[model samples]
Target: MAVEPLPEPLRPAGSGPAWRLRYLSTSWNGHPTVASGTITLPAGTPPAGGWQLVSFGPGFNGTPDRCAASQAGTPPFIRPLSEALLRAGYAVAVTDYEGIGTPGESSVVHGPAEAYAMVDIVRAARRLAPVSRRWAAAGYSLGGHAALWTGSLADGYAPSLRHVGTIAIAPTTQWGLQFAAAGNPAAPVNPAVPYQGRTLPVTHPGGFRAADWFTPAGLDLVDLAGHVCIEQMAAALTGLTMADVFTDPSAAMGEFTALFDPHEVPVRRYPRPVRLAHGTADQLPAVLTEITAGQLAAAGTDVIYTPVSGADHFTVAAAIAPQVVQWLEELFRRP
Candidate 1:
């Protein structure tokens, strides 16, 4: 399929930071695609040595325009995260993903499309700047799932781009289990409500309203379900047993069982090192990380699992930033 032309570049609205923001049009499965965001290079830094690439996946269904890196809002999320990486001597690329900024709804379903967009964004970043192809992937919640999925298939997606390592902080690993636990027998419920601390907006284009799908008490129930689902999915996908959710012997033995099982994916199969962090008291719980660690370890991949005793999913980042940064630094140092 012929790729679409790039969008016109939007000038930086302010001089908060010296960075370049551009739009690159690329193709995924023959569809015209546009990825827009800013790339931050360290001040007085020359691009002689190949720069390390950090491709970030943002939480929930956030648009790249909202990232701190784009200078869209006061205290951008991407800006702080990217600055941390830049101070650590890494070049960063933040993708708006398929639907966040340009057009269409984000491919929330964990499939080839989201994975393709993420991989393409990294390539697009390299083309737009003087950066080495060596890369590390990181994300939170939904973005975490994308990072792991991309890291799992990095070799085939972009052979030129080195897959240094990946980090998934409080990732949403199992959609099917999450939905089922959220009291939806037929579909996955919205995973954004708990993080937002209120019922999700009913105006969102996605089907189903917050009130229609979940009661007041069901809000907390959905959070619990999300926690259970992530653990179960990791367990089922990785051939580990984190819980008894899938206890039916016949259901457990089926071939396609693990596809929907969330736990059967074995995320560690990707040809690179991996790190996972979760808080024990997190609204999402730390068992998900434990299950993830078990599965990755079983695959013989270099894995680092941190169980923060008092932190919740939202607060784990601050508590574990030092470890996360060190792990990423080690990955980029590899030849």
Candidate 2:
């Protein structure tokens, strides 16, 4: 990786405050590689101790190189919530994961890839800035998953740094519903996965059968995600029900099962304070937090789960921005 001063395209602001685009040296899926990101420092002077760091993980946009948030010319505020962090005298570092903008297959929503991106960006930012040891993470949607993963892996990946807490808004947390969608459906379109693997039947959502949950149209969009950005993918797949797509509804990809496991979910074993903002009406299902928070609290993690009665998944990001910022303010000030 080319180590040097930040570049022009990455400059978060015109001149006053500081921001930079830089390439970092890190490992992707275990192999050392180069990744990219933007780091922005607040416009004002730091506190007596120093500026606290908030490494941000932006939600999934797409897998293509241009889809990387930093490369997409993402505005200074990745989220309105980030403006709050900057105003509060915190420095923000946003990573592009390893492949999204670099030389590799976009790992989709892989946990380890997002985690490494967040952790390594922090390490990279510290090299060029006067950052304090105290830090926390905040992300929404796919990025929310990354925030939790960052906190979970911080101890092992970047133990030298002190992590205050994590804030995840509408994160992909409902693993039980997500994992069991095809296996257990209201109606069975031959839902069972037998010992013998074969394409059983192609069907539709006549009743509530599972086999047709993913429509062919929907599956096509999944394939599109490999090469396009998030907005385009969502627009293509949003209204098409799962039943329309595949012979086996939702395709119960045997490959994705490991990620949906409790152990694979974020915040399960991470020992740190966590704040989750979920909307009851979210497309992903609010019940995911019920399972995650219950277990984390039981395991001695200080977890706060807030459900917005009628908020949708995307809208919930703006709804909880202030509270999440407040939470960070309180935590970073703690002894």
Best by TM-score: 2
Which RMSD values do the candidates have, in order? 9.8, 7.2
Candidate 1 residue-wise lDDT, 1-335, digit = tens: 11232222322122122333445443334466665545544444546656777777656533223332243321232334445666776666655555455544333433444556667767766666577778888876666776777777778867887778889877776544443444323323233423221212211234333334344444444344333322332232343221212222233223222333543234545678888888788766567667777877888788788787797766666666677789987887787
> So what's the TM-score on candidate 1?
0.67
Candidate 2 TM-score to native: 0.79
Alpha-carbon runs more than 4 Å astray in model 2: 1-28, 73-78, 182-223, 250-255, 258-263, 266-269
What are the per-residue Cα lDDT tens digits for candidate 2 across 1-335? 34444455655443224444546544534767677777777876667656788888887666678888776755433456666677667888888876767776554355666777787777877776777878888887777888887778788877898888888888876554665664443323221122001111211113223323344454454445556665565556444443444455444543335434533555455677888888889877888766777877787788889997788866776667778778898878777
Q: Please, what is the TM-score per model?
A: 0.67, 0.79
**Candidate models: Cα lDDT each:** 0.55, 0.65
Residue 133 in candidate 2, Cα distance off native in Å: 1.8
